[model samples]
Target: MPVAPAASLRSVRTLRGPGPLGAQVPGSGGAYWARLLPLLAALACVTRLPSFRWPLWSPDEGYLAVQARILAHGGELYETVVDRKPPLVPWLYEGSFALFGDSSLLPLKVLAVTAQLLTAVLLASLARRRWGDGAGRTAGVLYLLISIGLNPQDAQAATFEIFMLPCTAAAMWCADRRRWGAAGVAVACALLAKQTGGAVLLPVAWLLWRDGASRRCVARIAAGLCGPVLAAALLTTPSGFVFWTVTGSGAYASFTGSELHVLGRGLVNALVLAGACAGIVPPVVRVLRVARTGAPELWLWLASSAAAVLLGFHFFGHYYLQLMPPLALLGTAALQILPRERTARAIVATGCSCAVFLAWGFLAPRPDLAHAARLAEAVESRTGPKDKVLVWGIHPETYWLADRAPASRYLTAGLLTNYSGGRNGPQVGEKYAVGGTWPVFREELRRHPPTLVIDDSRGKPYGPDRVPSLRRILAEGYRPVLRVEGAVVYARVGRGGEGEGAVRGG
Candidate 1:
């Protein structure tokens, strides 16, 4: 592509008059990227897709994918294979698997990238409504930078937060337009993505109610909120939806998400995000100072979403992913509010351009996923397609790569023990003893009896003496067959069990 001259960039400064600082031609005539900033931002997202040829970094990625794999093959969600989250994320994974097949990471990457790009577009449009063209473009660019750089561990995966963003952005945009009905529907869809999405409804509803919307409009908004929720509820048996999404949810978060133990761990993550937003802090303050700010709902959104970032109790990277939208808006305003002097604006734009480049360049590397392939190698040596295996830890990637069914339906033992520790939120009652469905886990193990068990030590915290039956089952029924990457494997003693020996690597 031919490089446009530096002067061309100046033409993007949209103005009230049809002069030099006005709109340019539609074609690729110098300042094309400026006019098509949103479109370009989306395409940039697509082009900047992460390298999929690595091992999965976050356990949640594999966990959700495994659930999707199960669902794709006709297994039930909460009843058969379990997770405490709402059903939307896994369903999207299910859809991707149907389209791209479950074997490659490409499907998940594609799904995440597409959703992220759409979010960028919506976010930019929303910023433009409240700010201006400069802020809109700036928001789009900053969101892309911060999202991809936020948490290298979870950023690349098709995380629930990633999917929720477009819905949240759309809802905020609709509310900005006083399209109360559309905003309500958008937030309902957001809830389907992840429960944190429910927070978005606060800002939307507050705006509608504060604006003195007509009673008919209020009813329309309420109907939109109820419609999607009711439809999603009808998809599952009423009992299951109530139990998993609500009851089980409270149990799950109580321990894993809301526990104080995770606070210290998350503090660093919060700092990192804050540092990333450092450039925009000044502008954010400035934008807020204006009494008649166009995007008044942003303050409420910031309050709700920022509160959500803290409420989850856990400091997981993806949890912080919830803060991107508000940060992007504020950051965009910061970028746009610079001095109108040509030299000052030019210098600021140049600095921002370099910042985006530096962030993308530096944050592109992923965690070593190569070891997972090795584990898959060693695992496939001992198991086959029909044979079930227990990831006695948190490495669900093993199950995905080996193409085997999870012997224990729960993702990790941590979830099970969470309830016992009183860290249990709503879901991990006696049913999902740890982090999953405990009774079903035990039944699955006893009835099917996995051919091999990969004793992932992550699930090792037996917690206040651990479950005695589980200890006995492992001690008497399974024997250690191998060890790899600090993960030990225990093969079922009688069901095509291997001799007592350890193969160091797969």
Candidate 2:
């Protein structure tokens, strides 16, 4: 092992003390929790209250829940039930399902809440280390408040962005304290949670070079970064993991909207996000004002996060969640220099953001979970418990609602249609849907055809009418049984009834 030079040692000591980040704020004794508990409780209530009202929030949560159920029942990941994300999130969902039955989405909600709370705590700790107790509290509060400023789906759902935060925050926390190996492991853990988490390494790397870390320190960080990912690959289907996380990701990222649409949506997203996070404005301004004074690492962190947000080109509200923790930390550091009327500015900012989203929500239609519930009820009424169901379009919520297994590995029709999330229309991605998912879809249907096929793609670009194979399958072997809203239910002949009849509207 090599020794850190005297200058490096001094730098570490300085960071350990109150010079840069700040002396560790007093956290011992009863006084700490006494003051902090109310804030945490309020945060939990504000963030999760909406979650508890429903079993599921978004389609993303629905699919992930179904995937978790598949795993809980001894199904393999990527092979049995497929998704184009890294395995950790599904694994976490599996753990939640294992503990609490997969019958309800409460477990998943709980997991999301826990992740957010932990991230806030970690952010507070980070801020306190550099600033003071007040900054720590402010940072934690700002994170919790700003996190939930968006609509329930983006803010409350147990999505990838929500899970990635604590790991990334913790990584920086460790790096700031000069714990290289732990920091590396934390960064890798964040990546496992979400692909964008890989962006966290840039700031960490910059820290290493800036600190002039010893060769051994650098090696430890490298080992930490690679260790978990390699282990995950070894444990699961390595080929599947590589393909989904890397190759498939490329295809998904190939969405290139027209310049006009991109600019329009980008402006809207920016305004809404800025409004929602209005409270953070003072800290943001203060931090930028003193950007050269210290904490270049935080600026790097924010820059990298910004790059990650733009990587997809579709700037969804949740995408902006990645920017909050770094902002909170930097903002907290500038607490000493914050100008007057900070609270009033935050309140006004909050009002503006809320109004923007509220107006947007009213103007634009949101997916009604009630319709899904109705569809689920109809499917459940007609089908037996053992029968598997296949849902067309992106309505995986149907499968979760009906409490049925999916007939195919492709949970949604996106792969079949090459209709990924970012783009508005169902056009093929940069390359054709990774390795031709249609063949796999056909084979799966051939071997084990679904008892009930819910066609939720009536008006969609990838609707059955547009896809020849799907249309033929519907016409030949299946008959329409029921229609609920836009969704048309088809049942396999001989299984559904004596003879084909006109589909009856629900």
Candidate 3:
């Protein structure tokens, strides 16, 4: 047989074989991917393990876990939980809890880790199909590293967003191969995962429409859009499924431009978004340039993915995590196109390292778990077993720590306090009252009494004009029984009817 042309050999090697020119020559394709994929998976697992033991559960995670527990106990989804988010995430957690028995964070953590690995694998497959196996492996390895580096707390198993990256990758791959049906299924899975996934369909349809005026392309996009609705109806119960259709308008309406102290928090959020985008820019630009010439399909995917993320949701950092893997692959593609020089490669490597370090150091700290735990214990010790504990202007960690049923209407003042300069704390019987004042609190106490009230005094100061509601309660019939490090527990005196119970700490 005649030898292959030099250009053909180079193209084959760059796309499928080993390195750019003279890197390690692969003996076979299967063996190379088999070895590389596992190593990448292991690296991904190691980075996320630190989060498993850390007492850093966000409000979303805490709420989802509670909802999952309720579902496990045969309660309906939205009716019993009444959160603004969709039900798929809670259902996933419930399934995990059923299998693992809920003793450790292993189940939830594993779910995220597994999803990340699967995402990496799908990305590699997509790249290999387009550029060749070698390029695909490089893309896969880069994606694995980026996913670990940008480990958003929302990437945890308890949220629907974790499914976004994998579903997006699968959809792109199917579309690239002209397998419309498979692409539709992937898009449908994405939609059921989160509304942002639905936004991605627009970019996908644009890409498909560009390829041809074929009726097949239109059919595919329609199928993808309908997939989520059909799946929801078939998989979820009627009573528990209402959350799928709920628009969460109240949740969005509550975000009033992050005014007051919230402005400080908003500024911090802005900086984080800027840094994340900057870190991924070199790679994103590279991928866009390459796709403009070589692979239009990949270009469409990147464009659609970015449009889905930026235009779809309010700028939450975790919402951008799904976009990172594709950005990493784009970076690898950029590397392939650049002049092969040590200095250029060194600059790229340094930029990536700095970005990863900043993200981990500045963005990933576990906030206020210890303080919340201490407050929870103090409240649990002072309150009766049957007494309901209401946390106003407090972290949800208090509920997790105290093992008490949360009040129907929690004051999210704590979230606002961090952003504002004002100091505030929740007062006794405030949730039972209408305006959370003395007269309203008094009437609420007479109507539906709580045996004990826990006041969190650890936060910012409420100016002279805004007196703590608990102060008035102390003047009336409630007396401070115990004051812990950052929290105070008040007991109902002569008027009390309920008995206190033993406190247990997990």
Best by lDDT: 2
Q: Per-residue CA lDDT of candidate 1, range 245-265, in tens?
A: 777655445544334556755
- Best-fitting candidate, measured by TM-score? 2
lDDT (CA) per prediction: 0.65, 0.75, 0.55
Residue 411 in model 1: shift from native, Å?
2.7
What is candidate 3's local distance difference test score?
0.55
Residue-by-residue lDDT tens digits, candidate 2, 1-506? 33346633433332233654344566673676568757876675555666666677688888888898888888888788788888888888888878887888787777788888889888877776665566667778767766766666777678788899999998988887788999999999999998899899988887788678789999999999999999988877999888878776664676554445555676776665676676776665644443333567877898999998888676676777898788766555554454446644654565456545444443443456888888899888877888898988786888888888899888887776666554555354323465757778788888998888889876767777778888888888898878999789998998636227778998
Q: 65 in model 2: Cα distance from truth in Å?
A: 0.9
lDDT of 2: 0.75
- Give per-residue CA lDDT, model 3, range 426-493, as digits (tens): 32122322222335334555666566666664543432114445456455656656656646565676
| Model 1 segments more than 4 A misplaced | 1-34, 37-39, 46-48, 51-55, 255-261, 286-294, 334-338, 341-368, 419-436, 458-460, 463-465, 497-506
CA RMSD per model (angstroms)? 7.2, 6.0, 7.8
Worst 10 contiguous positions by lDDT, candidate 3: 419-428
Q: How do all models score by TM-score?
A: 0.82, 0.89, 0.71
- Indicate whether candidate 1 or candidate 2 has the larger TM-score: 2
Ranking by TM-score: 2, 1, 3
Model 2, backbone clash pairs (residues 3+ apart or across chains), number: 5
